[model samples]
Target: MASSQEFVQYAADQSSGAGRITYRKMFGEYGMYCDGKIFALVCDDQFFIKITNAGKRLAPGLTETPPYEGAKPYFLIEDLDDRDFLTEFITATCSELPMPKPRNKRKSNDTVPKRRHQNDF
Candidate 1:
């Protein structure tokens, strides 16, 4: 099942204290970002935070699972009500993660060349 919009909003709101939290639709689920760095995912109505040494230190027994099949295992966070804990943990995780690289801008003149088919040739 796909994650509910309410669940993604709650997750983002809970972690807002840590930084500028945002969520984007990805693969029919949601990817949560903190200050431009993706740090978590909301899939199947569950929240899965990216695993980091800092996060492991915070929750020693954190459940780990991939939000999607064949993806890297993430820390499966079940405590969504604990606002303080959620914010702090997110802060720690983001601290350990590198900032996102800036995206390259496409030149206005950039365009894809059409391929000539055998019939057209």
Candidate 2:
């Protein structure tokens, strides 16, 4: 398994041209989040972009493996040296995703009205 620091470095290097990519340590692996949304993950020193129908078609040879046991499948980016292909894949994935909705800033308690107990029937 790749160390979190190493994975972060790898993600940073791979996403040099991409704007403001951030790496967060998650479940012993590293999740690469672009603009506050997850776009990729790093495991065993390999970068895997989130799989989509277009990405699957573009890189049919790439394996769709679960990041962890019993997890959903993600596109395993086998060729780290292929920058052009990686870039295209990233672009395509980003384009296909709908614009992220703004997260509600209100606290859960504040959002939910307080319940009052009434006499039992």
Candidate 3:
């Protein structure tokens, strides 16, 4: 089942301490990003944070579960009421995740051949 927008927004608002929290449609679910790095996801109304060493250290009793089918387990965050803890935990986790890869740049002329000047050769 698809997650509700209200739930996604609540997740973003709760993690605002991480800085510039945003959510996007990702593979029929929602991807929570901060500073261009995806740190968590909202699937089926459940919030799941990426399993990072920092996260594991912060919450040792985290319930590990996959956000979707055929995916690795993430730290299932059940307590969203505590905004401070969520922000702190998510900030630490985001620090461990790598930034998004730069997109490939292609020159426009590469696709269409350049026209030769009519000057005498």
Candidate 4:
């Protein structure tokens, strides 16, 4: 799996427009987020955008497969060597996504009660 930093850099280079693109490690792979919604994923050094109704219509030939075992549908950019097609796919996927919401700042430990399973009732 590629490092999150490496994945983000690659996504940044592939992306266009003024919109910000971010990446985070997810399910042992890299997930690309535009605004806040996940638009794409990187696995085995390949990019695959989330399947959208619009994208399905635009690129009907694209394959919808899980990036890994027991994963959701993702549109794999079969021709990774084709930069033009990759860019177009990314742009279309990002356009359909809404801006991401800010993540909560609370710490995991802070939210957990000190007592273990106190409310058994």
| TM-score of every prediction relative to native | 0.88, 0.73, 0.87, 0.66
lDDT of 2 at 69: 73
Which parts of model 1 have CA positions greater than 4 angstroms off? Answer: 110-121
Q: Model-by-model lDDT, in order? A: 0.92, 0.74, 0.91, 0.72
The sequence of per-residue lDDT tens digits that candidate 4 reaches over residues 1-121 is: 5545664576556654424677778867787776666788888777778887778877998888887778798987756556576667667777777767778987889788877686764
- What residue pairs are clashing in model 2? none
Per-residue alpha-carbon lDDT of candidate 2 for residues 1-121, written as tens digits (9 for 90 to 100): 6556855686667675555678878878887866566788887777778888878778888888887677789887767666677667777776676656888887777778767668632
Q: Pick the candidate with the highest TM-score.
A: 1
Candidates ranked by lDDT: 1, 3, 2, 4
The positional error of residue 116 in candidate 2, measured at the CA in angstroms, is: 18
- After best superposition, candidate 4 residue 108: deviation in angstroms? 12
Judged by whole-model lDDT over C-alpha atoms, candidate 4 comes out at 0.72
lDDT of 1 at 85: 91
Please state every model's RMSD to the true fold in angstroms: 3.5, 4.6, 3.7, 5.7
CA error at residue 81 for candidate 3, angstroms: 0.8
lDDT of 1 by residue, 59-100 (tens): 999899998899999999998999999988999999999988
Better of 1 and 2 by TM-score: 1
TM-score of 1: 0.88
